[model samples]
Target: MEIEFFDILSKNGPVSWSPNTVKTRLCLNYLAIPHKTTYLSYPDIAKNHKSLGIPPNPKGLEFTCPAIAVKQSSKVFALQESLAIAKFLDETNSSNSDRKIFPNPGALSLALLVQRVVDRILNSPVAKIAIPKVVDILDPSGREYFIRTRTEWFGMPIDDWAGDLEIAWKNLARDVDIFSKMLVEAANGPEGGPFFMGSVPSYADFVFVGYIVWLKEANEADGESNG
Candidate 1:
């Protein structure tokens, strides 16, 4: 149970700010793992992670948060990426093995499939709406890093990311309609409702909810900023 959860900090605090970190938080909640969360600014992620001896990511950014340092007996190992971390938590479920994320072997595939679909279809439109407001939620350090990276990533400034609110909202609604139809098709039985897998929530639910939580929060921040 000796674990340290690293997450990005925003002005709104550390509970459920960043979508990626929120996914980790959801997985941790699902596992009921006791861990202390350590907040870091955007610039601090690379600095602190390298100092911590956490290896760079194989694919994208070398260092990122929503990471965990798990200690067993004498050795400490670090893990990053929300889905990979979820798999780890599932494997290490010593307490409630029956109540699990991967109820069957095929569930892992399902979760991965759902995650891919979420990343492809929903991430951009939602992120387009969320990123600008997210900048308002960060302190100077995090804000600066967020703006620079996002500007390069999006090929435009933060303000321009959500420049046309009317158009952005319309586009978002269209994407959401497509996504909702997906959920409807999956809702086959009485067990189905909010979750992708009916009443039984899974990692896929957490993955989809992570983006949505941030979107909702970002819109809240947008309103607060306007007022």
Candidate 2:
């Protein structure tokens, strides 16, 4: 078999708290894909994103830390956005063909629902907590923009910062409850596995794993900052 190669862009030693980045790494690990990580500083990422074809965000064109580059036919395809990258890699590799990482016709509906729930937490409440951390590291002056963007996107009251934090926590708790129930259901299945699809780790597994790490870190930081 020809050796498969991938270039994963990451911060904090290839696998830290960035779920999207970690998702890519975990999926690669699961697939046994040989890869190398290119650790880029903030300045390097900013300078290269446009050439890399990554769209700019408040985080800048670096695409929020965990961008991936896939090598095929001597050309590299750089992908930003976690789910898009995950689905693309899953489909590209044959080892994942039978596994169905992104779900299929039968499970597609449930997968989408799970995806939405995951996205809400990651982009909403989780983002509420994390944007500050990112801004602290990447753009201290842009903190207001981060707050305003999250508030507007999540449709939360602009003045109610404490209220927004509470809402985020409540929303996250509901999601965790739903996930716990699903995990229980999955674990009891005929095949028996800790993944959503019972025997195989699907897209939900990667998505859930990413968020759990983020939520935990955020919670820990909240505790330390207060204490």
Candidate 3:
């Protein structure tokens, strides 16, 4: 069974990052789910996303990236939103003979909680500082202002960018505590070794990896701007 995944190769204006798409791919990779990647361009993705059944304002004006279409039982299931898509991949791609993508109820719950934490970090004030700066650095002045103002509306501290940065880092630290706890739990769980659910990486690991990469990219962008 092959799955169709939409992604962007470059960060163009109005084009959303395929964080969820990347997560889905990671899950599929770890779980050994067969899939094909389709690159969606800015022109069609920006203007015709609605027609493609992608929510325009998923996560609040964060255009949906990494939408997936699954083929099953002679029908196709199209999913938008990163976390939901991850869950869908877990449920549908179970081969019945191998270790599951999500495992049992306990693992599913953990995946859900970890994804929630990802949401917090992504929307947090501190994380907001990095992306707009990257966008501003990469885009034209007018587009940069739009990105900055959007960040401002979404908890960016325009008045005290430094103060906001401090608060953002503090919030991230708080969230990281929870993440670390989860990691500890995984380390202590039965059959613990390499992954959150056990020896094999689960859907949660994929989501975790995606966010880690995103944070790293943001930090790199921040350092470049500061330099």
- For this target, which candidate reaches the highest TM-score against the unseen true structure? 1
Lowest summed lDDT window (length 10), candidate 1: 218-227
Give stretches of model 2 more than 4 Å off.
Answer: 1-13, 41-46, 53-65, 94-109, 121-123, 134-171, 221-227
Better of 2 and 3 by TM-score: 3
C-alpha lDDT values of all predictions: 0.80, 0.60, 0.61
Model 3 per-residue lDDT tens digits across residues 22-73:
6766766666777777665434445445655655663465455577777777
Please state the error at residue 53 of candidate 2 in Å: 4.2
* Cα RMSD (angstroms) for every candidate in the order listed: 2.4, 5.4, 4.9
Residues 102-155 of candidate 1 have per-residue lDDT tens digits of: 776767787788778777877777777788888888879999998899899778
Error of 2 at 178 (Å): 1.2
- Model 2 lDDT per residue over 1-227, tens place: 23322223222233445566667667777776566666554445545556667666645343455667666677766756666666776677776455455556645566567778777644566665554454333233334455566578657744454345667666666656778888889899997888888877766787778766665554454353322
> Which has the higher lDDT value, candidate number 2 or candidate number 3?
3
Which ten residues in a row are the worst by lDDT in model 3? 9-18
TM-score of each: 0.90, 0.67, 0.69
